[model samples]
Target: METEELQAALESAGLSQYQSDAYVAVLELGKASAVEIADACSVPQARIYDVLRDLETDGYIETYEQDSLHARANDPGDVLANIRGQAATLAAAAEEIEERWERPPVDDHMVSIVNRFETVLDRARTLVAEAENEVQIALSPAEFEELRPALAAAHDNDAVVKVSIHAADESDLPDDDALSGTVTQMRHRTLPSPFLALVDRTQACFAPQAHSVNQYGVLVDDYSLTYVFHWFFLTSLWEVWDVIVSERSEDPPILYTNIRQCVRDIEPLLADGATIEVSVRGYETGTGVRQNVSGTITEATYAGVSTASGEHIPLAQLAGQVSLHLADGDEDWTIGGWGAFVEDVEATRITVESIQYE
Candidate 1:
């Protein structure tokens, strides 16, 4: 496989563009010199060595030292086996991670009951560092001061920051005048607990009511419960829910946790004749195997779905088996779930990136 075919095949096996080029070049030339390989691959000769080094590291190429270094493609069969082994290793790790964290694949989660104050602060800082998009926190002014570095890093990472000080005035901060400006928005309010932090509106850590002031905190990344935390603090207790400070020009995809709810949500727009893009990831109940798919939603009903490949399965069959990512732009409504509900699913999620949703 040379040119497009070779490139596609190498890419499918997880080779970088340059690595694919170099590997194919080496294989094609058969025992070629570095310059010859570079020339064949159309890669800069000076840069070829680095690419070759990476390829060798990945077991895609074998290098020999002589008057000048020479290289050859690793045996195709051996490389294939290596790919299989690497893939299996990755899958096993993913399974272990999934076993520990089955909700939305969030990286760092602190769901522990620690009596020590240091443990609480450490976990809160960890959550801040792991935040990828937005950080919505409800804490005292003092607590905010303590987590300043973590919050600053989150802000610098371009995450939208929302801070609600529970019973503390923003103006009365003993320090952090400069850091205060970095907060996208600040509000003052009262809360039931001493400390509460929510990141990306998807995960939260709240100090449960206890005899001690900040006795222990419970962290949760589960979608089922985070909404309550947001509503309780951002809406009920604190009162200001305006995240008017826009993080992105476009809103993030609305994540629907349940299959039936998603079906109901999309029911009204049936007349729009929208070609939906749906991505699904879930477990095949029968095989106990996980699957993932993201593509156009061709057929759907209250019970199950047909997506990406025009195949449909019943809901009870995949009960609690799927998660959906949906966006209805001007022309189409895109939905995505893991393999449990869709077909031809891949590890790398595909989306309706072509359309812009307002």
Candidate 2:
């Protein structure tokens, strides 16, 4: 390297500019009077003596009574090692900057454990904003408001957004008008609960309840693991809660938060020979390939329901298994919910886009 560049590198290794310059000069001269170092580098004659003394004290050079007090570069083993270590550190930092500049690829492990709840929440914001089919979240009222903008953006993109606000009382509930256009359905639970956000049925961000003994978070990018979190969201955080805001339509083109709700509403319609033309957004069960399918609902099947007696069935009753037979053009597909192990497709959002009387 050039002398100026080498001197700058030495300065970066914790040397003052004058000390670096004087040391480089002594190393070049082998043994030089203080006047020689000051002449070779930018160190002024007035400061050359003090600079050489400081360099010798730090072992970068040794001063001796040679003719008129000369400084010779020391063995330089330690100084070279220190400079090399600093260069390595700088190189590693540059690589890190480049790596972090781009979006990181999802790791092969699918699940990442982290220390802070905010990490999961921040990732949830990005996932929610990009959600294609569905977004499920359970958080405190304040967190709901914090994520509201991203939720609203997802909702605007026609994604199904269901949120459960936990640890909230009547006073913590957001005004209904404030919730409009931001969520498909919102429920409020007065008890504390863990934070969770599941997006598109494939990714989940989860954290333990704040009062838990050990606080941490789990971020999942795998379909199966995310399905587990999805059910936790349904059973533990959402199903039992009372609706605070529901943007569902009671008329045609009805929107269902999930496949179970859609099946419950459409079972009677199919029984009455009403052809349900629906559009569904979800992924294939076996391949995890996502698609939007528009077809006729030929049949609806689920356990724990009595269509013969017209008895009212709660959604939890049919949670064990629910599937719909969809006839699209010349093909037929069986659609299931959240985690469909046996069916062809796992429907995340089902809409009664249009219906016809057969």
- What are the Cα lDDT values of the candidates? 0.59, 0.83
Tens-digit lDDT track of model 2 for 147-217: 98999999998998898988655887778766988998888888999889998877888888889999988
Residue range 1-358, candidate 1, lDDT tens digits: 3387968767777888888888878877888888889888768988988998898888878898868878988778878886688778888999988555422233444344545555556667888877766677776666877888888888887666777665434355434464554566666564435567777556777775435654655667765476567656644444343332222323225343234435444443332455555555444434546554455554444334443332334334344334333333433332323223252221222222222223
Question: How far in Å is the alpha carbon of 173 misplaced in model 1?
Answer: 4.1
Which residues of candidate 2, in runs, are more than 4 Å off?
1-13, 16-105, 271-273, 283-292, 305-307, 328-332, 355-358
TM-scores for all predictions: 0.38, 0.69
Model 1: number of backbone collisions: 20
TM-score of 1: 0.38
Where is model 1 poorest over a 10-residue stretch in terms of lDDT?
344-353
